[model samples]
Target: MKIVRSKEFLGARAWDAQLIAAMQDATVRLHWTDQPYPWHVNDGQEVFAVLDGEVAMHYREHGRELVAHLGAGDIFYAAEGDAHSAHPLGQARILVIERAGSV
Candidate 1:
């Protein structure tokens, strides 16, 4: 994983791409944007907290769509092994945390 040497210049609503490698511990990511994110899945469970704007968590299954929106200080969990999608609901900032499980 890329070591975050510092938290400098981490500003408002924007989309940034980060790749974490060989991380077996919990990690946190901050997102500030109002753009649609592509469908994807991660290797672990994730928690998202909307600290500023709004974010909608989307899931597609069996030809149906499910949606949930989170506002300021709202929190949600992303299931492991599920194809999930997310996008900012408004101009917003979010905190994402991923936990590491036993090997």
Candidate 2:
């Protein structure tokens, strides 16, 4: 059994993550970041959940750019080949689940 105090988690660099678990072909990770992640499409589906703070989720749809404001407890789902990026308002902790070894 494992216990993680999400609020107590921190990383040395932006987007640094703590591996929470490896479930079959997917990986659950706790990430701490104050910076924006570059826009990219995942090889598989991705689930992004905000654990604390706020984030502005930027995504491209039909070649148009859009943004979704997200706060704590909000969840964002990205299907395969969906291009998106995340920009934290200040500092935020997020839980992400995606295929193992995905970028």
Candidate 3:
């Protein structure tokens, strides 16, 4: 058994992640970041959940740009082929579940 304290987790660099589990073709990760992630489309679906702090989720739909503010306990789902990026308001911890090897 493994126990993780989300509030106590930190990384050496921004966006560094702790691997929580690898289930078949998917992976569950805990990420800590104070910087924004670059925009990209994943090859499969993605589930992003905020565990601490806040984030500004920027996404594109219908060729338009949009953003959604996410706080603790909030979740953001990204379907395959959806272009998106994450910008933390300051520092944040997020739980991400996605297909293995996807980017």
lDDT of 2: 0.97
Judge candidate 3 at residue 16 and give its lDDT.
97
Per-residue CA lDDT of model 3 for 8-98, tens digit only, reads 9999999999999999999999999999999999999999999999999999999999999999999999999999999999999999999
lDDT of 1 by residue, 10-82 (tens): 4443666232333558766666566877887767788777777677888766678888877887898776766
Estimate, for each residue in 1-103, the C-alpha lDDT of model 2 and write its tens digit.
9999998988999999999999999999999999999989999999999999999999999989999999999999999999999999999999999999887
Weakest lDDT window of 10 consecutive positions for candidate 1: 4-13
Which pairs clash in model 1?
13-32, 14-32, 53-92
Best-to-worst ranking by TM-score: 3, 2, 1
Model 3 lDDT-worst window of ten: 1-10
The clash count for each model shown is: 3, 0, 0
Clashing residue pairs in candidate 2, if any?
Answer: none
- Per-candidate TM vs. native? 0.68, 0.98, 0.98
lDDT values for all models: 0.66, 0.97, 0.98
Superposed model 2: Cα runs more than 4 Å off: none
Q: How close is candidate 2 to the true structure, as a TM-score?
A: 0.98
Clashes of 3: 0
lDDT of 2 at 82: 97
- Report the candidate with higher TM-score, 2 versus 3: 3
